[model samples]
Target: MRRIPLFVLGVAAVAAAAVLIAPGDDEYPANVVLPSATGLIPGSKVLVNGFDAGQVDEVSIKDGRAQVTMRLTNDFAPLHAGASARIVWKAVLGERQLDVRDGPETNPVIPAGGTLDGKASDPVEMDKVLAALDPATRTHLSSLVQGLDHTVVGNETDLRQTLRQAGPAMEALGGVLRAVGSDGPAIRELVGQLNSMVTTLVNRDQQVRAIVSGLSGATEAVVQQRDQLRAALAKLPGTLGTADRMLADVPGTVDKAVPLLEDLRPATDRLPAVARTLRPVLADLRPTVAQLRPTLGALGTLLQFTPGLLDSAHGALPGTESAVTSLTPALSFLRPYTPEVVGWLSNWGSSAANYDSNGHYMRVNIPAGISSFDNNPGVMPPGMVSDPFPAPGAIAGQPWTDAFGSGVR
Candidate 1:
């Protein structure tokens, strides 16, 4: 009242106006404290019941941690004491909110002084997360998007390739679809054809059965002859062996028969010549026998005389006993001089044969064949000429038929 300053008078008026216009304390705004949550700046909205309860009003350091104070309108004050609150999405745009769920009917209410049990939410901040993204991460995301766009763009090409790879199958499917498209005619015709074929087969069934029955009968017949077949098969080996032996003999038989077969033609051609030569010889024999027949009649009387000659022919051979006895005495006497006699006889023959006609002594050289000669003259062929000149009277000493007969004997 006594001369107060103008600034002090205005501050007092503003304080009185704030107290009078403010909502009443008993009608209280909600207290939403970030008692456990730290790093929350002032003016951050506090959520309750999935809606904005209030904003962070003040922040201060209490004990070792930051304590945040918040104010809620009286509208959400009840939610603070009676319900649970959690962060929730407001919209797809850059906004967020909290959602509250009331407890079950029997659940006790949350005390105002107690903690809300909130934790730090892992939220994607549109503004902050976008701002924090570096060039590389943004580039990677861009590339991913571009790749997706490219994949979408190439979908037609990929689809065409797949279709091409599946061409035959797709064509089959198309044919099946076309077949299905025909209402009934195609199917009916196919069915009719099938029916006809089945009918034809059915009609021929009896013939087929008959053929099978005939084969069965043949098989039964073969089975009935099993023992006979076995016996025949067992004998086959012996038969084959005989055949092989015959085959083996064929070559030897052919060798012997071949020369006879070759001579057959020539022999046939000479048959008349052979007969003529034989005929003359036989005719001569017959005539000679006829001429001898008269002589033979006379020879009949001579035949009686011929008996004496025939009887003398019996004595023609020397008596074995007397001749053997004579030979012993003669051979004994001749044995000592046998070698000297032989030598003298050989020299005499040589001397007589070697002399020429004039009696002038002629020398004869031994022939080349003398090497094959031996002292044993018994081994030599009778009358084999060993001298260059004939021995004197050598041929005259023997009868014409006696090659070694000596006239002296």
Candidate 2:
């Protein structure tokens, strides 16, 4: 009896499991027929408008019309009536789903046994995008694809040859990568060397910074002194002005100095001759002075004797008083002669040459002919010479005259 009970329990559990694994029963929503959904796949998420509302259970064809059964969510019963259904792929190669869109609010719910007369989407049926293409474009596309297929089929040998040729290189690359992966010490040693190099550079960083800073300061100083540097530069304006003035004065100074220097040059050139001549003369003059030195010493020594000599001479000078009376007549005779001498001097030379009228130059002397421009008149043209020629606003010695009829104040 217990075996019978156990058998009954086993049969009941099997029946329950069978019901649990079964496909959709007749209790589910009735399948709707969509003539446009022939190529749609099963298990695709069905959308109402843009929202997920159900999944497609099956796709069927009958009497040249497609039928897709949509098992809708509980909240999407509004899609039961008056909704348009279309089929679309999930992704490029993904499953295809049926989507329903609600018409205007007044559109009645789709009847239970009603047919959904709708169009397939672009990818599956391509009714919309296909309509835009010309019939010739379709024929060309078909021919192009056929040509491509033929060409690819024809190049199978070449493709296999190329792939076969690439095999060795790929294997070599793989081997090299595998070798690199196995090189532990080389990689670690390289890393250590890199680290050591970095440390060395870091140790010298302060010196590099100091050099950089010094260079920066030098650059700044140079920038600040730019104008002074430019002034000191050998540019045309400042440089040539100095050159021009120097050159301009060189001729005149050379002219003035050349003759003097030339005259001195001869004296300099004859220095040996003069020295030779003066050598003996100076030799004789030295002895003559030496000989005169005794005489001068004797004269100096005779200071005491000269007073006694002078006393004797004074004693020798007897009375001139008696002669003074005779000298009166001679003195009167000299008075007349003095007046004649004064008149003779008046007719001698120009008043300038007179000692009382001590001006050295008054006129150009014919023998002294044009002594200098200093005393010569009309050396420069009249009005052409002044202390500074062409003073302010003067043009070629013409004084700047005011707009009025008078000279500038």
Candidate 3:
């Protein structure tokens, strides 16, 4: 008032305007994550309940996430949990804004500088929509719609009746659709498997045809032998009954035979090696067997004669025993004189050996004994000169004299 400087007053007015325009500390900064930050920047409006609530103070990328810092007014303080924020636009190319649909008031308030997790909604681009539909598809769609419209108009009554009848069918179809939808992956796999099987069958068509041809031939053969087959079939029941009885006893048979089988196991295991070893032996034995053939025939002949020989020997055996028994007494009587008789015979044989074909006879000579030859000739020598010698009593002269008496009278 007292001559104030005009420049200073001007600077003071600018300072008051800055202070009035700047945001106060009462505002809360909420961090929101968006899928994308396209067409968004700082100073973008944040709306709550279709009203402007705050502005985005910062927009940045941290750790690959698009982060938007929204500074909300004090009236909208403390966003609760489950509150969501979306980036929306008026039109495809319009300016983007944040729209927060918060949770109930009963939820706990979010403090200042808190975070609110959110998603970004993408606006439909007219150019992309236009690109998706080509001229031909658009033409077909128009024709299809026209046809459907005309059909619906003409079949109103029939359509109503069809819809009435199809109500339960539709309900059932809904359930089937739900089942298919729930197991869509499994159903798709099943369809793929069926398709593969069909393709394999198609590839093996020639084999399938051959199998069919074989089946037809078998059928014809069966038909030709139908009567025989029928008779066999008629007898089959009795055969089957017998077999069934045998089968029923098989358990007991097997139980009894188990020990035998176990015992035979070792032998059976050794059989293959034994058979291999026997092969060479049997080959070598073939020639021996051939040579034995004639020997076998001779043996058979000898065997026939053997019985007769044995019978004759058997009959003679008793007499032979009796003969041996009868010689026992005579043998015993001569047993004592055997040595003396043997000695005497040996000495006499030695003495008689002097007589030989050379006219040499053994002479008995005792130097001191009387000589039988005398030089005087007697009228009759008391010895017979005939072929027969006289007896000792009949002889007249003493032909021989003993020490006690004359020899002959």
> Which is the leading candidate under lDDT?
3
Q: What is the TM-score of each candidate against the true structure?
A: 0.22, 0.24, 0.28
Task: Write model 1 residue lDDT over 1-409, tens digit each, in one string.
Answer: 5557877899999877555333455222333333344335566666653344576666666664444555556665433334544444444453544344445546554433334433335555566775789989989978999998888785988878888999999779866764574446778899999999999988999988999999999999999999999999999999999999999999999999999989897988898999999998998899888898899799789777987897786786568667878799677545544555676788768776755667746455666653465775545465555544333334445222222244122
lDDT of each: 0.62, 0.67, 0.79
Cα lDDT tens digits for candidate 3, 1-409: 6457887889899877544433368677788887787778899999875556899999999789899998888787667777889888745665788888787889877656667888886766666775799999888978998999988997899999999999999889877875786678899999999999999999999999999999999999999999999999999999999999999999999999999999999999999999999999999999999999999999999999999999999999999999989999877555544555676687667666686678556545456422245753534445534334433322334332332254322
Q: Over 4 Å off in model 3, which ranges?
A: 1-162, 238-288, 292-409
Candidate 2 has a TM-score of 0.24
Candidate number achieving the greatest TM-score relative to the actual structure? 3
Q: Which stretches of candidate 2 lie over 4 Å from their true place?
A: 1-30, 36-39, 111-114, 122-409
When superposed on Cα atoms, how far off is each prediction in RMSD? 37.8, 37.0, 22.1
| Candidate 1: stretches off by over 4 Å | 1-40, 60-66, 80-82, 87-115, 122-137, 140-409
Worst ten-residue run, lDDT, model 3? 400-409
Window of ten residues with lowest summed lDDT in model 2: 21-30
Which pairs of residues clash in candidate 3, taking residues 3 or more apart in a chain or in different chains?
A: none
Sort by TM-score, best first. 3, 2, 1
